[model samples]
Target chain A: MKKTLNAYSEQMNQLMGKAICLPHGPFSELHEAMRYSLNAGGKRIRPVLMQLCYEAVGGKEEIESFLMAIEMIHTYSLIHDDLPAMDDDDLRRGKPTNHMVFGEATAILAGDALLTEAFQIMLSDALRHGGLERIRAAHILSEASGMGGMIGGQILDMASENKTIDLATLDCIQLHKTGALIAAATKMGAVLGGGGSKEIAALEAYGKYIGKVFQIVDDILDAISTAEELGKPVHSDEKNEKNTYLSFYSIEESYAIAKALTDKALKLLEQIPGDTSLLAEIAETLIKRKN
Target chain B: MKKTLNAYSEQMNQLMGKAICLPHGPFSELHEAMRYSLNAGGKRIRPVLMQLCYEAVGGKEEIESFLMAIEMIHTYSLIHDDLPAMDDDDLRRGKPTNHMVFGEATAILAGDALLTEAFQIMLSDALRHGGLERIRAAHILSEASGMGGMIGGQILDMASENKTIDLATLDCIQLHKTGALIAAATKMGAVLGGGGSKEIAALEAYGKYIGKVFQIVDDILDAISTAEELGKPVHSDEKNEKNTYLSFYSIEESYAIAKALTDKALKLLEQIPGDTSLLAEIAETLIKRKN
Candidate 1:
């Protein structure tokens, strides 16, 4: 999985490189804001999960474009989440946030533009190649990104801040806030790869489990890492009194839960009736990550 | 046309009413911030256009859900546009902006939740009454709302704040920021109406013209209307030093242009085989409006 991840990062960079060339907003500042966040760089895990799952499921299409789109949406969320009115963070991906450099107004507009542009790219005939798979992919992406999924989770998380949360309540928040998108990524991959309903369902289940693990890790990392090591300011969740997985579980307990979730995700891969090794490795790599 | 419009609004509300009942997010101040702007009264112009075009094209499918989705998208844009960090406007649709009501952070999230909810409503089975038409409608809505159109125009409009814009630039801004959604509305109407290539093309052409007409009227209203009468504060364009059609063209001349564009739209409708009476009446209503 680590070897695949190295390859995945390279592919992601190449794909992001192509998408970055597309025309941006007329406002130079807004464009700069978007560029700053998008180019700041990260593990690019979302798109990688999408592409690899896509390949495992028979997604031989122009997979790069769809991957580019997921990345854009991911970038948009970060840009907005880091805004003064949102997360109020000063740094991200080892650099100043969009608002820190371009001002809040431009940062706001830039995030808005990136979000809209992500959908625009999907709607374009050039990107979709007019295939139903891509169109379906777009629909799934929208569902995952919108209120019933990531945004819904975000709302709940924001509302829950400074409030005591039970384990069940916290689990629900984490599932929607983070798990929905990760699940969507894998589902999109399976569909793109020509996987049938059963296969897609398996991948989606796989994603749901893995997505939980991802968030648990993020919560853990938030507690343990410095801004420099994590590439973003830390201690905010505690500062804002936001409860995450780590808020309730001990570090060892959180680790155990992440491992269990990863195992569940790997188990689901067997339903695909194909080579399940690659996906298990992806799940393992995710659970084992340090930064 | 008025009857059709009233019917469209009713249907859209009825459809939208169903989706929000589901527990998607924490029902708190932030969620309320979104619902406040969303459920507030306004013309469902986009839905009307979509249904109108759908019917005009011999499309008999239930498009109510998709109709609501587009309206939600439009409403979200308005909510966000009125944010302090963006337009800093105190009023929208005759009431205080979301930020004014919920605070800036919650307001931003409210707008975001609405944007996400719009897509969720469109994708869920709860709103999936139109099938293939749903996909087509989504494609149209996404493009219109995305950067290639409305968002693009927004970037231009925001950039134009306090800066003089040329006639061509102002026209382009209006064409996108305001016109794109209108175009989408009409084109969606034509598509759902079962209009073929030629009919869809004609409606789209007409849509572009009326899109211009709608903006001209708004510009005119802003210049002349009082805040009390208009609901929202008036002359906002002038206050911001933003360019408007009225600024680029003489007030009298822009009205002349509006009349001309309305006429062009009406003529295009004639060529498309739709009920010329309804189309013409709507155009005339737009051209002759007092508020």
Candidate 2:
């Protein structure tokens, strides 16, 4: 499973590299800035999960565009999140952030362009494929990552900074800021894979649970992992004065919650009538992830 | 035609007010920032033009979502464009800019939310309407407003700042920065209205011409009008060291080009078999406007 995950991550990197590369466009500078951050390596977890979900649901047709599109959206979010006006981070993925390399204006434009480009990729690919499924998938992805989902979550997180907020409010922030897009990626894969209502619902449930697990684990990693291992700053939540699972619960309690959510996600996957071993293994790896 | 334009503008205002008013969302601050600029009151030209194109092509179904969606995208651009990172303006439509009112972080989130919300509205509406047309329209708008269109143009415009750029670069800036979205608005109207390929092509051409005319007049107005009259600061082009028609040609020559483009837009409208007088009148008014 680990070997397969690595292979999938490698494939996604190559695909995203090609998708974002525009060598001779008039706005090549903007494209360069976009590529600079996108190529800054992460686990490619979102796209890999999406592809794994699709494959688990018996999908065989090409989903490279969807894979690339979701990664673009994730990359854009990271770029914007690192802006001086947002998280104000200097480094991301162990490199100078987009603004650090390209300047603020170019970084902003790059983020904006990448967000818009995601829709363009989805739409053009859907049109080429000639189906309503891609459109549905696109719409689902947009809603999940849009105002009510990721952006909403981000706003909540920002507003809660340096303030004592309740667990409910903290839950809202976690659910939105990171959870929504992760759920969208998983659900979108199921939808595109032509899963019925039952399968779709199960996958969505799986996504939601794992999303929680992912965030909780992230908070734990931030608390324990070194910057060298994390490839980004450590204790960012503390520096940002952010409320995380670590803020409200002990390390053991946080790990328990992550474990429970992973169990929930795996159980949901079990209800789906498909080979979900990769999905299950991924969930296990997520909770056990060191960085 | 003036009365009709006023009526459409009013209708758009009402629709936009409702669309942007998310009374109890978790991200109400972001929503407020979005509404701060959205309700700041422009001529509602894009939505009005979309409606006119729809009506001109004999479209009768409710297009409130598309109308509101385009306006949201336009408003988001305005919000981001006014950010400290971008134009750093204090005023828009004679009031404080979104960032000025909501702070930089909220304003940025607001802009990002609005962009995503545009897609949400279109997709949800399309699904409810049970047609591929809305999805198609959404695609066109995204393409026009995305990398190779508005954002691309913005990048070129930004990169050209504090530098001596030629007429070709200037043209690229104008065509992309403003033209693509305008063209999208016009073409989207025809598309949603069920206009055939010929009508769609003609409307797209009309949008391109009017978009050029509109930007040229904007430059002229920026050069000649006051902040009070224009409801925003004048000489911004000069302040930013950005090129425009006035940068390369005499005011008279610039006016000639705007007039020529407006005339061209009207001619294209004439080629389409519909009541296009409103569109023609709007073009004339845009070129001759004092503000």
Each model's DockQ score: 0.44, 0.75
- Candidate 2 per-residue lDDT, tens place, A1-291, comes to 345778988988888788877667788888889888888877898898888878778798988888988888899999899999999998888899999999888888788888888888887787778667888898888888888899989998998899999989998998988988888888899989988888888888888888899899889999899999888889889999999987789999999989988988988987778778878888899999987
Chain B fold agreement for model 2, TM-score: 0.97
Residue ranges of candidate 2 with Cα displaced over 4 Å: A1-3, B1-3
The docking category that best describes candidate 2 is medium
**Each prediction's Cα lDDT score?**
0.76, 0.87
Q: Which regions in candidate 1 have their CA more than 4 angstroms from the true location?
A: A1-3, A23-32, A125-132, B1-19, B23-31, B121-134
Give the per-residue lDDT of model 1 (tens digit) for A86-151: 888998877888888887877776777777667666656323364467667777888788766777
Predict model 2's lDDT versus the native: 0.87
Best by lDDT: 2
State fnat for each of the candidate structures.
Answer: 0.44, 0.73
